[model samples]
Target chain A: MSSVGAAEDPHHLAHGHTAAARDEGGIAPKRIVVSYGFWLFLVSDIIMFSAFFAAYAVLVQATAGGPAGRDLFKLKMVAIETALLLASSFTCGLAVIAASARDMDWTQRALGATGLLGAAFLGLEAYEFSGLIREGAGPQRSAFLSAFFALVGCHGLHVSAGVLWCGTMMAQIWTKGFRADILRRLLCFGLFWHALDIIWIGVFTIVYLMGARS
Target chain B: MTDTPPDGKRPWQNVWRSRIRTSLSYVDGLMRSVALATRRHDGVEDDAHGRAPGPAAALDAGGANDHAPGLDPVAHRASLIGYVTGLGLAALLTAISFWVALDRETFWQPGVAVGLCVLAAAQMGIHLVFFLHLTTGPDNVNNALAVAFGVLIIVLFGAGTLWIMSNLDTMMLPPVPR
Candidate 1:
């Protein structure tokens, strides 16, 4: 049968009439539509980060006879930054759980913790960047430094955005209560925060860890 | 409109009374409409005709515990476990990644890069499943498809750049003297 005919056929509905079929057919909830759109946005963001990763990988060896990754990387500091971010992601997950359970106080507390951890992570990153620049190892020094700064700085920027978003969400929940709209926003924030952590893992491994060794 | 009063009272008095009454009714109607709109937006109405509750119904439902369809406390508890598990695994993976990178003497130095990549991919998967709630159910199939397409694009972009650049590195340079 043709695709249109199949859609019209009652048999099609009978064989595992999943939620997607019903939602797509019409009457899909606002939450589903918004989240799907948000997911698309996240995917586009991942593509952009992937491009940055590719650039970093290509120029990793192009240090222009200046300081290389091994000369500049501080594994102990990066480890602390990684820990802060990982902890923040965990707390963000807890916030989501509290939101799902409709527990207002716990949600606020978890989100507050997540925000603090995220702030600490950003602070360490800024310190690291400033230190590197002070030592004349800034992005302008070499192609390798340029790519390194671009990749890590971009991830830091995302973390900064996540911190701002977390604060906004706390205010929204305070004023609006746990309304469905607020809940949807919370869900999106959780997704965004976790995705940032994932990207950081990539950055830590490829840029910090691998670069130091190579 | 006639200026003369219908009743025996003063014309201006009659006109003022009528105008005030009309404006009062208009204000009353406006208040009622606003109240109704708020109720509808509160997200309390049931999922009629397979529809999810609207946002305003949330307030009408009276409390956060009044979850809509498909969102219950039991499921929340289960998801909590998933989140904790994801957190623990992610921490473990991060530690392992650091260890492998830092301690070059333990593992073959050449394989560390590949090992780190594998660990990073695994951590990403854990986050996607636990934190992002990405899964294979019907409701999430579209999300899965979108993510899959994204991964394909990322792989193509990354791999294609490496391939082209490495080729250029070989072909663009003049032959080195023996």
Candidate 2:
């Protein structure tokens, strides 16, 4: 088998020039592909959310004449969730910028901030879910409750994954610095993070806000 | 023509023939109009020359002029206007959606509700086109393709699930139990 250096040597000039040109163009092909991968992942994620949306639509009135969304949903809490998630997305953007600039300190700080805000958003959601469950509206209580749990729980799970992923990336950045691989990973993470914000906008509109009023 | 198959037939031959015919007519009409315009512009000059000037010379001159940068203030203003107008439209739509969602009693009419859903979808599209810059450049092809695939899967799965679940509800839990 050829050594790594041997494999790179033949294509080194060509690849270097192309990579430099990409950088000069204000976007790296690696970064672009990484962003596309995130989008593909988000598409799969949207499939999951789509299932949740369908469930919610079918069970929107499955309250069994008990406590409906109007009774349970608090717009204020949801607003906070929105704020936290949006802020996390903003920080995730900043993290991407920092990574691009190779500013390790700012990248770490921005990613750390994103992780914290994501955690806060997840916490609020968990609180909301648990509070509803404590009030005799658990998932097992009714179909409406079940659908609600599944939908919101899925998003909460995504936020949890994002937080863990961000934390891991932050550790890698802190220890190894902003390597190309790490930057690619962070680019994917940024897309995933922002996609969540977009999904949350849908959830807020269809489930919480509309449900509350209906 | 010399590369015909042993069977003296090509499956794609029919398809190519039809497509080429359609494309040829389009190109012919376009070129004819271009020729007519050029003739009108060079009426006197064309008479002066015993024959039309060489196409190569005209092409070279045109290409040189094309390379010269021209003031594009209008395009710049148009892009700015597109951005600002897009954002305001999105915000306005969001506010209206919120208002409707909050006042559901009045907006719950079936037709109105569906309209609102359509409006929301439109607003999402506007956000994609304007703020996300999804189709702003050649490099964005991958981005657009990814988004399209994602949306297709999501819509298919979401709608399918809803349909199946609703059917199950009717079949399993009839209003009047058997």
Q: Score the docking of each candidate (DockQ).
A: 0.21, 0.11
TM-score of 2: 0.64
Worst 10 residues of 2 chain A by lDDT: A19-28
Best prediction by DockQ: 1
Compose the digit string of candidate 1's lDDT tens values, residues A1-214: 2233344554665563444334335655566677788899999999999999999999999999999999999999999999998889888977876665556787899999999999999999999999999999999999999999999999999999999999999999989997877887987898799889889988999999998887
Off by over 4 Å in 2: A1-28, B1-96, B103-133, B160-178
Q: Write the per-residue lDDT of candidate 1 for residues B1-178, one digit (tens) a residue.
A: 4555567677788789999999999767634543443444344532233344342232223323432222222122224456668778888999999999999689998888899999999999987877777765434667889999999999999999999999999888797899
What is candidate 2's lDDT per residue for B44-147, written digit by digit as tens?
A: 32112222234323332332231101111111101223334544666677667667766647754655556557667877676555434355233456777878
Give lDDT per model, in order. Answer: 0.79, 0.66
Note each model's CA RMSD in angstroms: 19.0, 22.5
Q: Could you give the interface RMSD of each candidate, to one decimal?
A: 9.7, 17.0
Docking class of 2: incorrect
Cα error, residue B1 of model 1, in Å, equals 99
